[model samples]
Target: MSTVEPAAPDATTPAPAPAAAPSAVEVRETQREASRRDEIAPWLVALEALRRKGEPEWLAAQRDDATARFARLGFPTTRDEAWRQTSVAALARTRFDNATRGALDDALESMPAFRFGGAFAGREAVFVNGRFMPELSSLGKLARVRVRPLRQVLADDPDALCGLIGAAADDDKHPFLALNLAAFQDGAVVEVPERYTVHGPIHLLFISTGGAASHPRVLIGLNRNSQATVVESYVSPRGAHSFCNAATEVLLGDGAVLDHVRLQAESEKAYHVATTATRVSRSATYRSHALTLGAALSRHDLGVRLEGEGADVELHGLFVSDDAQLHDTHSKLDHVAPHGTSREVYKGVLGGRARGVKNGLIVVRPGAQKTDAQQQSRNLLLSREALVHATPQLLIHADDVKCKHGATTGQIEDAPLFYLRSRGLDEEAARALLVWAFAADVVSKLKVAPVRESVERFLRERLPAAGAVPGTRA
Candidate 1:
């Protein structure tokens, strides 16, 4: 009788479903708290040092402008529309003093060395802690292509330098960009003459070694019918704690073509914030590939503007994060001229308790008739605790333009995992195989095969044992 009474459905009791795992939201909150606490003292020191630098009058004016802007528009918060997915609170916590002029740091000795086998062997520039190192730099001149340090360029052509300083960073609202505009120490200037073609790739290495934050800049200009390839790498030793605020400005004239690639693999405790600003002229073609592999907190911002008709631009990016790292990418494409086209594809792989954010925006101006733009972002979470936020947006003012945007966030494919396992592979082997295959798309797009192989090797060395197949050779 009692069993029969108990069998009656209990309104307060229900069957328990599988429990969902906790996310990294709590970890992110903790990190934010730590960031805010550590960032203040350095900032005050930087402001005072910069005020006393006693640079040129124009430079002083620029610094004043930047300081005013920084005071007006501080670090972005989650409430900011463009920064909803990525918070700068941690960055705001500690301010970095202006990097001190010092000797080549010993901390840089442990960084991954840049090895050139072919194509890129003859063209190279090495910068240590935001300063060019002549002894470490080597390059064979290409016909009609000139590459030199920014200080040299400024001394040789002041007008060009002034133009580049503004061209590289015109964003008054962005504090970091303005700060870089006012405070960058030494940078690179690359100029490609009209109607000339560079057969070999040019490699630029940027190594951050000091504990102080440094700002490095690069200016690249291509004349009509010119063609060239540029590679930029950012790296540091293990567990190094520093800040890198860098910027690159590129201009492509009519019929010009450029292949630009940036590989960022810094120290696990470092902070990286970089901007790539590009303007494409009539009928020009610009292609860019970006890979981010390190840093405790890293943010990559890309701004591409089609300034002339028939300009075409393509952007591809990949980010891999593990441990407690935070990775963020903010990208924008502006179709300002008619008949212009742009395409963007971004992919991310996150493991452990890492967090990733991708925000891509495409805009077609009113007079940009027949403009075509496509944007896509895809994310893979290898751990239940990992978190990824993907957002793709389109703002089109032209009615006749064709524009599309898409975003996806998900875990690894079970079908692929099962298929690999069916072939006598262990769970770890299957997972590694799948991860490699997932990352291959971006790697294969590299213009040079050696670079692609190098990237693959880096991935192999960094990925978890479970995410790397046994006996696999990169």
Candidate 2:
């Protein structure tokens, strides 16, 4: 049996001095050894088990490569450039067992009202603890489109999923991506054929029951000239402290169009990290809306690559953090071909002692002329104790590109509160209205009516109560 290594000590703690002076060479070697000893081994054991279960040789090789990468990178710290603002040491210290094989009995009847009765009423796929439960799903037949559990696809024809799974995501830089590649058991797979258009959006629901770790992977592909919309929802029972690591990859063929909506509302005690990678081909379009509202420590990474001429991409995100929660979002858009266009707008609201971070980047590669890109990040602090950090960047290699970026972080304006109060609104109602208006910029971009309304309702229920902030008195 292989033994797992323990988590490293907190970075904030000072290291003890050596009894005897040591050479610099010896100290470097000792640091390397310590790093190796901190690698998580149980996750490797689970990966090996999956490989030994008769998975394809290619997949086994991929898992092995990812395992090595993850071992080298280990868990990130606040010292790391990408993680300089957020600390994940607490998550690393927690030892989480792999999820067990079981479905929640109340999964069907307990589906959240926000998820059901929508335009996507009977077209939802449900997964509990990273395992697909067909009994709770209602995915009917659609022309020129195929939706199936990823495990089923792997079991039937593993080769069919090749070149699409890890094509857009880079595990070398992100250890979480490596972890997902090494241990993800099952998720959703969607394929739309050439020139086909799905009338309704496809909904994927993932729920966790706490006390374990779940890795969920979603793969979506749209052939040339096809169009589809996908909705992904992540939630958990209140007070659950589970750990969730998820990755999603989307491929758009020439002239294809795809709209994606992601909703994350996990337990207040849960740890959640997710990455979304999208690649757009010639004349293709890809748009995404991300909403985050729950989790003790949550991070979402969005990466988009415009690899073909005339491709377009847009990203919109909103996050609300309360209590002592922490939420972070990092996004990157790469324009590699001529005539490529990209835009991003993210808004965040922080209350109580909560904190939020937003980092957005736009890159136009060399020889990519006629590239148009813009990024904006806006934040609101509902309380004096709340904090936020916003960063927006633009990297243009071509002189003929049009690129712009901006960021703003502050509290609600007293003018808006006074105006609302003058309109016969209570103090609490007025405050809530202003907060919603700040978030409406992102929520209004949602094309799905039910999704937009549900998100609005959720924000209304979670926003800080009236007069929660000390200086809000007009």
Candidate 3:
């Protein structure tokens, strides 16, 4: 679990040239369709559809706000200032067939990662392609907590929840977020009462079987002095080129705590765009760990806001990619109140022609004095073709704050590889060991044993032969 600096690449290798610009016809077609699709998926569309079916006013207003923000800030491309390093032009070519509204019982039963029966023994909510599967979901009292589908929650009491759901997501220029805002269907809602603590983790499984896109939203509320842990998983077993746009929001009350983890392992031909937003209150604690593998193109945006004094937050994440996979992460830690602390660490292992990007931003306002924040990103390249962009930024208007940011891009150390080989281990085994050890710093932080083990297995299977699991000697 060492946070060692990744070794620099040898000077002998040269970087590859950038891909050719996309065709004008292709770009124009996609942009036009994007505008149309954005409108179709906005809250106005959802609200109108719901109203025609006799829905409520508060929900409609929530939709109005979301749609207005969406319209204000439209889809973003790599050309945009924030997305300059992570080109999403490939998304324009993606055929993300929306997941049809149907019974996914068979898909759920046959899923590779759907192991909720044992590990997720308590109430579990299952969604295939973004729509809730009542039969697949086990909703009930779990470890002193009540769990139910979001649609049910809204039906019962929309006024109490609309603000929480809609307020968590603001208008991001990211197309994926815009699409999610427009197209999301049902989701899960977990409520923990005051002074309660859920002994086990709440598991939410999102599987994209095939056909249609999946936009799933999740909400969790922890009352004062309450504590809980949530694990979200996304997987696609059958289809190639599937698309998953998912979002989650966790609201922590005073003195509450939440440990959240998201594991994304989609098919090689798939595309994944996910966003997680957490708002922490006074003296609350929030920690998040993300493990991403697979997917031809994937991007995750983590936005955290410390809104009250004495809030503590940590974001630990890692992604291992190969075979032309593209992965990106953009995180913003906002210190809105004084005496809050935040830390961010992200690492990636890239091979083949895979590319990765990490953008970590820390914003401390003028009156947010006594704030402490640290951000760091590191990446390991497994091949000469691999590329990574690491940018760590800090905007601190507070004169009395302690903040620092750092980033690095490098590969496995040749000396370590040679030394391991001299000990009689083969080259492939030696490299794999080093790569695993390099990624272990983030993996070790996963509190859920099963989830952590699953991530390790994914890395072993996805990383190339040259990647070796470091020996116990290290």
lDDT (Cα atoms) of all candidates against the true structure: 0.78, 0.83, 0.77
Residues 54-153 of candidate 3 have per-residue lDDT tens digits of 3357656555555665655555555466777776655644455543554265465556456633677655777888877777666564856877777777
lDDT of 2 at 313: 92
Please give, for residues 284-303, the per-residue lDDT of candidate 1 as tens digits.
99999999888998988898
* CA displacement after TM-score superposition, residue 125 of candidate 2 (Å): 1.3
Off by over 4 Å in 2: 1-36, 49-52, 99-103, 106-109, 112-114, 464-474
lDDT of the structure predicted as candidate 1: 0.78
Once fitted onto the true fold, the runs of candidate 3 whose alpha carbons sit more than 4 angstroms away are 1-52, 68-72, 90-106, 140-143, 172-175, 465-474
Better of 2 and 3 by TM-score: 2
TM-score per prediction, in order, is 0.86, 0.90, 0.86
Which 10 successive residues of model 2 have the least lDDT summed?
A: 1-10
Worst 10-residue lDDT window for candidate 3 reads 1-10
| CA-only RMSD, every prediction | 12.3, 6.5, 8.2
* Candidate number of the best lDDT: 2
Whole-structure CA lDDT of model 3: 0.77
C-alpha RMSD in Å of predicted model 3 compared with the true structure: 8.2
